[model samples]
Target chain A: MEKRITFKGVWLPLALIAPQIVITAVFFFYPAGQAIWQSLFIPDPFGLSMTYVGLGNFEFLLSDPFYRASFVTTAIFSTLVTVVSMGVALFLAVLADRLIKGSGTYRTLLIWPYAVAPAVAGVLWLFMFNTRVGVITWYLGQLGYDWNHVLNENEAMGLVVVASAWGRISYNFLFFLAGLQAIPRSVIEAAAIDGARFWTRFRTIVFPLLSPITFFLLVVNVVYAFFETFGVIHTITSGGPQQATTILVYKVYSDGFVGQDLGSSAAQSVILLALVALLTVIQFKFIERRVHY
Target chain B: MVEKRGAGLWLTHVGMIIGVAFIFFPIWLAFVASTVEQQAIVRPPMPLLPGDKLVENYTRALTSGVNAPVATMLFNSAIMATGIAVGKIIISLLSAFAIVYFRFPGRQIFFWLIFVTLMLPVEVRIVPTYEVAANFGMLNSYSGLILPLIASATATFLFRQFFMTVPSELAEAARVDGARPMRFFFDILLPMSRTNIAALFVILFIFGWNQYLWPLLITTDPSMNTIVMGIKQMFPSGDDTADWPVIMATSLLAMIPPVIVVISMQRLFVRGLVDSEK
Candidate 1:
């Protein structure tokens, strides 16, 4: 995609790009290279020497119970967060799209939460479910259901997932609404004129048309759950309640910083790097195909 | 119009209202809690309505409350967010200009190098990046907080995509007028990119302000903490009751800037979000 007409200035262009290149090289590439390089070596407890053991860290992570558990936790956490957020967003977007008026008002009301930090969202939810003096918790006590995420593993996981999902609904909503509005009116009108019911029309036409955006949001939401929800987990549980809510990212932090297991944590990071690269490739590929449309 | 509706429209309205309420509930509760006294919150079934203690709690939070005063954290956050937004926009503008407007050596390689950074988020390289920052004595500094995270190429790619759509005749005219490359960039291209720069600023500002883990890792100093990460530090560890009112007040203050940006620039925020993701 070279421009038909371009300025001829080698030095100027190089200088223009130099800042970004330097930052990227120093902060981005250098650290990424280090993560890969460090994954194969284990540091002694004294911080005196490194042992070169190829594939040993990877092997240990694959078989380690906690690492395996983190993997499962990540899968469950990401899936639940993605499903809950996307489902709520899609439902809201559909209803908002159908409104003849006040959609913008609803949008304004709903979208500001996107600006709320994930950590703040976690704190807000935690405050409500605080077990003591928590309005929601106090109400649940009246219903004979004790709500305590502090000790309950599933409850802790559920709380973090919900908190993470709550902040993401606005982002998904915007994309879904845009996708819904992009559907040609005549196509939907044709379906309606053919005597299709609302649910039938939606399931047959609208849902199919929305698959692209849906798939895109799935990847985005998964990535969000993977990385961005660190704040949520940190504030609410700190991956506590017996490490039940510790997703892979949290594990990397805890093991590297807290546990001082550099080799295994670096291994986990390398795996995560690969996962993101794969997802980014898929996302870009989809964008490329969609560009034709 | 597709169809004029009565029952269905009412149902949609009901659904949308419920959705909006669900979205607003947590923040609304936080705001309510922020206004109430500590005892009012600690007691079960806190008042749902706004309390008269709003001024007292917020003032306490800003002036002399918490580990670090909320005011200081807010100032730190403001600086970090503004630095990240302005820095990212400036560098991205220059790089995007170069990519779109000039033919240069190692251009494609340089572009791909920037592109590759997009795939590796800060979380994956946290340990090594932290080590890098620590080695460079960048910890607890504003540059450390802002620089590493702004390495993303999303803004650059966005500007490049936009610049491609700009007609070549504009540049031709500038060249014919004897404008130098940078002179044309400053006088012509920059004016054209104002909307994009503004839109990207809104999104980047929110991103910078909402950052949690990086600041948490680097800025261990109480005075250096950003409000977003500082809120967690205010929480008590043991059975001791947290200053709920003050914490809630800090939460409200922490969110205000980003929320104001989003609401005031709703259109640009949405445009930047949609455009950047592409």
Candidate 2:
């Protein structure tokens, strides 16, 4: 990665990098190291002493039914958010890509929602689904269907998933549209000349060619669903309705901050740290592959 | 793109319109709710069109929210967002400059050190990070909100990537002209990085503005709240019903800045989006 020519000086380079190194060491490494350290020690109720439990915290978390449920919840939430957002985005991108005019208008109209925070998105969805005053709840009531996210686990999960996925559509759409545009027009036209209809051409040629982007978006979306959706979950369900929406990140927060089970939360944090590290490695590998392409 | 014009084209347009409409409906409704009176929204079947109470609701939110004034929260959010965006850009620029422009002792180690921060997010390290912030007496301060969040390696990585691609001849030429390192960076390199910096600023501003967990943790005082996290606080805690119009107004206010940035500088936003992920 080095350039052939470079500037000289040991202290000068150190001086340049000093601020970032200090911030990284103080804020990034220190807390991360503390999380790992704290995970191995069980603090007393008195908050004055700590007893080292080695891997006991991890063992307990693995056995805990609620923590296990949260794992399942995280899996379900991440999968649903990823699938829904990407599916809708790919569909819209295909539609937009088919247009010879007004695509820019459509892109503008579609992409602004990317700026809406997940928490704000959650609020928007919650306003629609709130049990007492929600407009959707009222409409559903007319059809003799009851809706209350604060009470029902399925409804809560459904709301959070939709809220999380909604704003994500804009991001996924932009990428998909970019990806679709990059596909060779000649290849698709050739498929058309071979008498393939739109769907057939898309399936046989476009989708296969787009798989790299699809895979990239898939991994990226999962990472988003895992980490960034904290706002959505926090604002809407708050891992509530009997913890139906408590994903791993939320569990870590609730355990440490709310529940004050420091060791358990730290253990969960370490686990999440590992999860992020693994996903990041996968993303880097994919990026390297794309560079080769 | 294929230049097809037929019923299929019409259908495609209709499908695209529906998708766009579906995307806009929630935001439209939220906007409508923000403009309407509380009773109008609290009642079933809120009006689809905007109401005349827009100014009233917005002013109410700005002046006296349930927790803190919306104006205060907005100001706090702006400061934190700008602080984060500017702070990260400056430090990352320096570090990336050091790593790419110099081959000093521990260069590789510093590069890897910054690089590995990508593996952990603020959300993962929430509790301990909060503890660290609290210990530093940064609680309820802008520094607490911005500093910990900016420690991520992305901007550094992005800048490093961009620096690597710059022609090495420029540096050699600068040296031949007797320009020192800092002088070269300021007079030459900084000018070259204008687009990248602008793009990164847009994205990072949004990232910082939209932050939820860190602000939620650090800002115990309602006055310290950023608008993004402040909206939730406006909801009544007990049996008291929410003031929907004000809350909705605050939501709109919170989103407007970043949305404007994204829409106005869209080309740069897209470029930054693609480049940063890589």
Candidate 3:
């Protein structure tokens, strides 16, 4: 939407935009273009020259068992993180929404977790579940269940998922609470007057109304699980126990920085770029439609 | 108000308390761990209550961390977060004002260019981006930490969204008074955008503070480490147990600034978070 009245000086406007344009071009566009370009070339091991392989890196990455496992691992990891965080958040939001008053007090209690960094959240959870001194792990041992995420694949995945989702709960809770509050009270009342119980009213009327925000949160939580959980995975398990918890982003980091396989990492990055682009498209299209409904 | 939830109301309160407790348990344990000595923590099933060593542990953390003082890491974090937050706000305000208020050539192209940065997070293009930064000699510098990430167009889109709602008559009246484009921007638009700027500042501050991978890659210097990423470095590399007390204290300290910002600016923080979707 253009402003009806706008200033007419081309150079002045161009001057105003120059900083943003230059920074975006240099930092964002150039690097992204280079990722695409680098995906086609293989660099020699000595950090010297590059060979034009032309899709060789992509082919190798697609076929590598480890890379393929990372894909599956990422899928499972993101799904679990999204589900766990969203489920807990929805539960909290519903309970809070049901409060006659003092939801704000509960909100204040719950949402401070939002302020904790994802990496810090990992440390917090890691402390609780730390193999040696972890209070929770010690308690679990009392229950006769051995808990060692460092050496166990499933346990490591679980720890990373929970740690990543821990801080995320607040974000989902805020949105869910907002969504719940935005549902007109009259509709629920109408359902109640028609002899609909609370559960019935929620499932039939309230849930439908909240679907737009639900969908929005789903996409957002998935993205959070995708890119932002790098800290959680890195700190908690280091994507370990045989790369069980290594998501796509972690693999990108590990390969690019640790392994120094620039070509394959660049290819993975290009694939990830495509993934994010697709997610962005899906978000805009679905969210725009849902909001209109 | 739909129906008197009478007994159900009490149940809701109870459930919420449980949910809140479950969420708070981790931080609570961290705090408890921070207060205790190392032996108390390592022996399994550490005392749940705060120990008398609170001051001692926190003092140790602030004065002398493993590699560098936690105080120094905190200082670096504050600089990085504030720099990124303030820098992005200035650039975004300018570009957004120009986009919304001017009829310039290539405006569409510029908008789309800024918009595209949203999809390309630093994680994806780490290698090449690092190479770019290295080429520019940005490593271990504050500018290196802030500049690349500031290119995001979130606040720009937000300003544009708000500007569309602003009455054109405001700009029209300003023009009649013989105000230049930038003068109108400074005199009228800047003041009008105060709440937005404040709200975005709250959110962006947290974003900047929580950064992990970028700071991890760029700042190999111990003194330059931000607290969020620096905590992981405190963990022992091999055999030795972590320094639980100091590490936990550092964890809580790392959280304090952002938590204080969010609680103090709760209303604005929430507004910024919801609005940041653009």
Model 2, span B169-265: residue lDDT tens: 9999999998999999999899999999999999999999999988999999999999999988887787899999999999999999999999999
For candidate 2, write residues A146-217 as lDDT tens digits.
Answer: 998889999999999999999999999999999999988999888787788888888888999889989999
Error of 2 at B257 (Å): 0.6
Question: Judged by lDDT against the true structure, how good is candidate 2?
Answer: 0.92
What are the lDDT figures for the candidates, one per model? 0.92, 0.92, 0.90
Flag regions of model 2 displaced more than 4 Å: B1-3
Q: What's the true lDDT of residue A136 in model 2?
A: 91
- Among incorrect, acceptable, medium and high, the docking class of model 3 is high
Q: In model 1 chain B, where is the ten-residue run with the lowest total lDDT?
A: B1-10
Model 1 residue A163 distance off true place after TM-score fit, in angstroms: 0.5
lDDT of 3 by residue, B61-121 (tens): 9989988899999999999999999988999888988898888789899989998876557
Q: What is the lDDT of residue B85 in candidate 1?
A: 95
Model 3 over residues A104-199: C-alpha lDDT tens digits?
998987888999999999999889888888888998999998999999999999888888888999999999898899888888888888999988
* Model 3 TM-score, all chains together: 0.99
**CAPRI grade of model 1:** high
Pairs of residues at least 3 apart in sequence or in different chains that clash in candidate 1? none
